[model samples]
Target: MGQRVLFIGLNYAPEHTGIAPYTSGMAQSLAAAGWDVGVVTGLPHYPQWQVHAGYERGHQNRDIINGVPVERVPHPVPGNAGLARRLGMEIMFGLRAARARWNNPDAVVVVSPALFASVIVRLRAKYHGIPVLAWVQDIYTAGLTETGSAGGFATRAMRAVEGRFLRSCEGMVVIHDRFAQYVQRVLGVDPARVHTVRNWTHIGPSTHMDPATLRERFGWPMEDIIVLHTGNMGAKQDLGNVAAAAARADQSGAPVRFVLVGGGRQRPLLEELAAHAPRFEVLPSVDDETYSALLGAADVLLVNERPGLTEMCVPSKLTSYFTAGRPVLAAVEAQSPSAFEVASADAGMRVPPGDPRALLAGALTLHGQWVESGGTRHSGGARYVREVLSRDAATKAFIAALNAVRTKGHAPTRTTTIATLNN
Candidate 1:
């Protein structure tokens, strides 16, 4: 029989954004490669933060998606829950995940973001003599501290708990080298146990569309320079800076319009902040076709981060932006992973985070280039996507890492066994 593996994560298929895509992609690829794969995941309720259509909030069910069986558990869909409520939800999901049917398997892969869930699942699997490999999407402790979401005492406690969870795993996979360094230095994990696998663009191909026609379709201004930012508008994004820049653009008559598309805990706050800025608009998230159309229609794609949010995550939006073959302008720390991706790909320019003036200036500069060059400046981002972010390469690397973990076997667990003797 082929090797069997189970994936435990809070997010999975049907949610195309954030950690869901990577987790779903990895599971499907493994199933396609002849490994017996099953997933224990929550009902789809990611960037939208609400249960998807046809899915109930508290129902537990089982089904197959793309040839892989999944055990879907229900958890609270918090739109803007406080830190305490959010942690409560995570713990609830973790407890339910531990109760999910466990297929006898060679190994298990635990996806983080639901950091507490990883620990819960790992301990459960270890009890059954199964080795687990952690797929760290974002550092939980770093996120809490960097976003100022938790106090110093709380952050330090989380760090210790999270570190212990990761150390107990057989191996770990991170999306970037910077994350691996943080794991080794701050979390005190063995360097050899960590692996790096860059995330691939999960969006469909973007085609060239007439800017005027798309602008009309999306109800955007025809004459204004469009600087678009898509995906989650959470605390880490610090989109308030973008609103401030748009207000400045309006005052200076820069002919620039800043649009944010997507939903998150911060959307209402962003809407209120951008209320007075004429050039700033917030739109609801759209379907894939409209999303692609919007990307093709924009003069520049943008990424904005909070001032000190240096290492929590590498925005998944960059992969899509690069695939759209448009130039990017990032308002992030100079040494962040987002800045590195932009600079290394020669795809766009970066300005200091939280500086509204710098962001506006950078957008204007990209706009000038677009106008002078007739939008023909196809940046190196697309090429980087092809050469470095290929889905096939990523999947193969993940499978190899999984196999390595499986081969090591789980540490011996002391379990009582009853024996019968016949006279």
Candidate 2:
């Protein structure tokens, strides 16, 4: 048998969050590569803070997805309220994961999300004497502080906590190159311990449905040009500029129609704005089939990030946009890593965040160019995704990292025997 590897994350299977697909794909790939893989995650309750139907609260349940064993534990989903509730959920998962590790030794554990799971990783490392690979999706402390979501004493406390967590890890994996620099400069993390591995979007262009069929099913006009935004609609997204751009497109008598699909705290506001404007269409988040169809049906995939969010966030959807074979209109800082992808892929245009005029102008220009070019928005992004962001490439890199860590003689934190049962 190959080396046993474990993954710890807040959200996983049955959850349609960002980390779920990435984790599932990685686990499946690792398992197929002849490694013994196990996953530790909380019950699925994301985008909606309620436990998924058919799952009961308990220690955990084991299941196989795509040939890998997954272990799930119960964690509370604080219904979009207090920090204490959210912290409770994080702490509960951390403690349960620690217990699970104590029982199952010999598994190489990696913690994800970089915020709550970092604590679990530290505890497991300390208790089991295991090496942890910290996978950072967001620079949580900086992201929260810069975004004004955290302030004053809270920011200081979180920074100290997260800094310690980063320092405790055997190695760290970051999605963007700048994140490694940020870790070294801001958190004082060791430069040698950090690794930059780009995130992958496993979905490809072949999954796309016919545009006319998608339009007919969605009840959208085939004649109107669709500008689609799919993903979370939280504060970090800053979608007001998208609405403002739609309003501008309407004023110019353009046939462009804006479609905002996804749910978040900002969904209510987006729905309100769309309800008051005929040019805007707001839909709730849909399954992957519908999402792919919508992406295929649209002329452009719009991505937006609030000011200063580019450094803190690496929008995984950008990879999906590339995979969909559509141009992107990204409203993000030019200095962000996203800008590099846009330029490298020649996928689309970038406008300064929060500037409605620039956004409006860019959208109009791109729409016109796409139409003039016979509606060919292809920039070879899909090919780029297949070559660069494919599961094969990402899984190979992941396995290399795991092999490196294993070769270093890293061991699990603790080991205990459990009673064997026969069916």
Candidate 3:
């Protein structure tokens, strides 16, 4: 029998956006690679922040998804979860995960975003003498800064707590190089233990769909350019800027229809803002087929971030956007990881965040390119996806990292003690 490996994460399959897809993909890929794999995750509820259908708030469910055994625990799904509520949800998940049957797996990979939960799981793993690796999707300290959340005690407490847990991990996997740097530098982790494995496109290849037909079916004008932003409309996403840009386009009579498809805490606010903009449309999340078709049909894919949010995340949508062979327009800080990904792939244009005029101008420029190149111009993104974001490559690298963590027989070497930075 293959070596046993277990994944502990808060998100999993059936929630097809955000971190869930990646976690599910990684877990399944490991299973396919001949490892005995199991997952301990929460009942699906994300982006919408409401419990998924058929999942009760107090029940523990077990199921097999794509051949991987999954054990799910109940966690709070706050309607509009603020920081305290979000933290509470994470803490609850942590407590539940700690109580779940680990079955003495060879190694444990814990996903973070539920930073507090990871700490809890890691502490428990230590008790069992199981090597623990951290799959850090985002840094909580950076999140506090980017979201303009209350700091001081909260920030210091998070940094110290996160630092202690991360440093103690047998290995850490980060999706972007920037994230690795932050983990090593800011979190005081040993550089050698941090691995950079770029996230692959979790969505399958999009089947070809005629743009005109899709636009017609969706009631989008044929003459206008379609600018689509799909995924969470959270505060960090700064979709308010997208709505503002759409309103500007409508007011100026630009032949562009801006569409947002997905849910988040900020969706209601975006709907209100777009109500007066005839060219703007807001749609709920669609099935995978429809989502991929929409990506194929759109003239431009967009990534918008709050002006000051330079870290904490690399938009997972970019991987899908790059694979869709469509031009991308990023409205974000130039130095942010999302901007770097866009620029690195040569996928699309970048405009400063929070500037509706700049976003409108960038979209117009991409529209011009779309017209001039007959829509075959986004080869850069396609090539980058093929070259950099291959599932096989990512899976192999992650498995190697996990194997190292599982096989390492000695204590993790520590470089520096956790620093309590006071701002």
Best-fitting candidate, scored by lDDT: 3
Task: For candidate 1, write residues 1-423 as lDDT tens digits.
Answer: 479988999899888778888889888888888899999999788777888888887579788989999999888867676688778778888989887776567888989988887888877777766889999989999999898999999999999999999988889999999999999999999988898999998776656567679899767777788999999988889999999999899999998899999988889888887687788999888877778888888988999999987888999899999998888999999889999999988888889999999999999898787668776654788899999988998988888888778877644542221011101
For TM-score, candidate 2 versus 3, the one ahead is: 3
Model 1, residue pairs in steric clash: none
The digit string of per-residue lDDT tens for model 3 on 238-339 reads 887788888888789888888999999998988887787788888999988888889988889999889987878999999999988889999989889998
Runs off by more than 4 Å, candidate 1: 208-210, 371-378, 411-423
* True lDDT of residue 144, candidate 2: 74
Model 1's lDDT to the true fold?
Answer: 0.86
lDDT score, candidate 3: 0.87
Report how far off residue 13 is in candidate 1 (Å).
1.9
RMSD in Å for candidate 2, one decimal? 2.9
lDDT of 2 by residue, 1-423 (tens): 777777888877776557777878888888888887888778887665668788888658877877877778777777673455777888888877656633343435455553775586566555555567777878878777768886679988988988988887777778778888898999999897787777888555545578798888877787777889887777788889889878887888777788888776677878999988777888977777777778888977888888886568778788889988777888899888788788777788888998877877777787777778775654768767877777777878777666655544344324432112101
Candidate 3 clashing pairs?
none
